[model samples]
Target chain A: MADPAGAPCVEVVDLHKRFGALEVLRGVSFAVDRGSVVSIIGASGSGKSTLLRCINYLEQPTSGEVRIDGEPIGIERRADGSERRRSMREIGRFRRDLGMVFQQFNLWPHLTVLGNVVEAPIRVRGLPRRQAMELARACLERVQLSEKSSEYPARLSGGQQQRVAIARALAMQPKVMLFDEATSSLDPELTGEVLEVMRGLAVDGTTMIVVTHEMGFAREVSDRVIFLHGGLIEEEGPPAQVFGTPRSERCRQFLAKLLH
Target chain B: MGNWERLVWNQRNVLLDGFLVTLEICAIAFAVAVAAGLGLALLRLYVRPLRWPAIMWIEYCRATPIYVQLMWVNYVWPEILGWPTTFYTAGWVALALQSSGYLAETFRTGIENIGRGQREAAYAVGMSPLLTFRRIILPQVLVTIAPSIVTQFTVIVKSSTLVSVITVQDLMFQSQRLVNVWFEPIEILTATAAIYILFIFAVSAAGKALADRLRLRYGLGT
Candidate 1:
């Protein structure tokens, strides 16, 4: 379902993050409308992962606010205008509404494929084991990995592991999904399987923020494309305008080198 | 000459008594070490600032000889506290604490080796930190560090001999008494060494077999 106008699902306002002396995200700001796919593309160390992490409050920002569904993500401001950091317990509850898939498949190797999908729904969400297993089966089916449920993650191929990772996240029924280079670790042939799963998510209208290097996927699946450079949003627009008629020399150079 | 042969032949009783004591120490120390090590490893997992301090504690215990720690626990702890600490309890406590340091370092390495993504995936699904560790992180750690943990356990078994210094009457202690009374140092010492070697070999075999079973069950290997 489409959200009403001016009701953004995610909003990052002047976010700044620093590690020692290096500022990884410098005044980064963006808003993701509900039920839309926004792809962030950039070279390595361009703060793409940092931005995604900041959205979920995984990495606390040096200064700025992240609001999800109009609620502040990680801080509570009091009547005195003083702010308090959110507790881990509170953050965990907030994260239930958001799911993140990493570059690595990140399946718990000791657990079976079904265990990986069933664990969070049962433990975190407090669903009954029977109901959680039912949900897990449905998610596995969506990823076309239902038959591999009893197998361990170490036995799966890179493509299959990534798909299982996707299924594990989907079982949570998150309102927003964040992907950080989700297909970068796989071989060319394997990358297609993960990308296909992601395409399926987009087609199903899952709200998503994808950080990727796959230009074609960005062109095809993204409703808006954001190009970040040196920890700043260098340019952003619809794919047709950004990819076809680039605005900045950096974007054009990036596109030229990448497309070639 | 016949009488002398009979005296030495009765060494089987000594071996049996020592074996029981050795088992007691190893079992108690291993349980304590794993429990304490798990706590320290979780500290290392979340708090980067605590990592070095935890390392220092582990290294300190490892660097000081186990025998010396046993002596201190037996002789010094009661004196300092002005309370009753029995030799038996002291022996187990010293060994357990020493093993804790080594096991803590091993567990930390296992937890760190697990990719950050694994924990993130758990977090993304809204898992509490304790739940995440219990369900996701700890299981992977068990698989990743099983070999090292088993090796350390065998080492703990051997180290139990040090408890003899604290008058624990363990295998080595009994061997020493037999050596003193018999005046057959060469023969008695050799037998003692042989028994220890045999015991350790059995433990090593058991550990390898356990690891194989776990790997097969978890599908970690083909």
Candidate 2:
């Protein structure tokens, strides 16, 4: 379903976002090539989550562009130099191509694990109930939660619930998966299990953009790392280079504060 | 004891018939209240253009006393709207109007109490707003507000007695008729009061059980 053969899986150019008087993202730009993993690392309030959200149009950008597989989303520009915000129907269709995982898990508590995974595929994708259930089972198997598919989210442990959330996203078969601090809300011990599933996805060459506080996972698993500072990219490069010898003093200090 | 047997027991068939009418009116009123309440609450919360009108209607229904509304609907509405042209129709309409307002507020509170994250999660998966509300939002709201909904129904049952003023021939109407016939208010009215207390007690108890069962089955209950 990925039609653009050479176009980047996800791209953002000169993105800016403001919440009232607070500017959360300022002129952020980057691209993730197909089948590559890029991790975004930043301090709290540095706009890492906001940047990820804008990429999927969850947080609308005040200005600039986000394109998925070379097609612009959220806002469309016309020849007359005016912008039209895309209709909810249009945006909703575009969002089907991207999967997003939240820090809160956000699983529908009323639904069993299988129900949560199959709901969108059946409702949004218009997949047959049988096909959706089959897809849901496969996704649950990938997360190693097939046994828990019949259970409600509240009955699951934190790690287990997050895994179900991942499976829920995976069922979409999205072109690029976005993780917005996906493991941040878990217990320290539980974070590892969720991170392990993410690492497996990276190994399987799923195109991904992860916003994280987990430095070890980011450094070891990511092909590239972008460190955000006050709504701007302070430094970005291969994880090895950014972590080993950062260019900016802020990057150096941030890494030092985290690593030690 | 003789009066109890004569006025209360001997008049069992009349009282029973009136009780059935009470049940019928309450059932119709409660059904309308649920459906209309949900519609009004959604309009108030989601439809920007209709929000103020929905709010005014809900407030009007709530602020007026039930008896006054009953009288107004029974007397004035026919002149103004030329509908609900019978005593029975007016009785249920007035009852439903009153409860619909309270239930609308209940539904709004339930919908608002849901976490924003739930809707965002549904949207993130590509579900449209309507789909999200139907499949995700409404189910959770129903479970969370089930107890309050049951309470509202009891309130409706209790308030249904006032319909007798319009000659609706409900339980209260029959008991009053018997009082006029025997010219004895003590025996029959006491029996009527006791019957109402017991009937309401049973309805609420059953409703509570059903709500609890729903919560245990679908909610995050342990």
TM-score of each: 0.88, 0.96
Error of 1 at A129 (Å): 1.2
Residue A106 CA displacement from its true place in model 1, Å:
1.7
Q: Write the per-residue lDDT of candidate 1 for residues B29-67, one digit (tens) a residue.
A: 888888888877666667788987877777777788888
List residue ranges in candidate 1 displaced over 4 A. Answer: A1-6, A78-82, B1-11, B40-59, B176-191, B212-222
Runs of candidate 2 exceeding 4 Å displacement = A77-83, B218-222
Q: Score the docking of each candidate (DockQ).
A: 0.60, 0.71
Every model: iRMSD:
1.7, 1.3
RMSD of each: 3.3, 1.8
- Worst lDDT run of 10 residues, candidate 2 chain A, spans A1-10
Cα shift from native, residue A213, model 2 (Å): 0.6
The native-contact fractions of the candidates, in order shown, are 0.77, 0.65
lDDT tens string, model 2, A68-176?
8887898777899998889988899988888999999999989999999999999999999999999999999999999999988878999999899999999999999
The deviation in Å at residue A231 for candidate 1 is 3.0
Residue A99 deviation, candidate 1, in Å? Answer: 1.0
Per-candidate clashes, comma-separated: 0, 0
Q: Which CAPRI category fits model 1?
A: medium
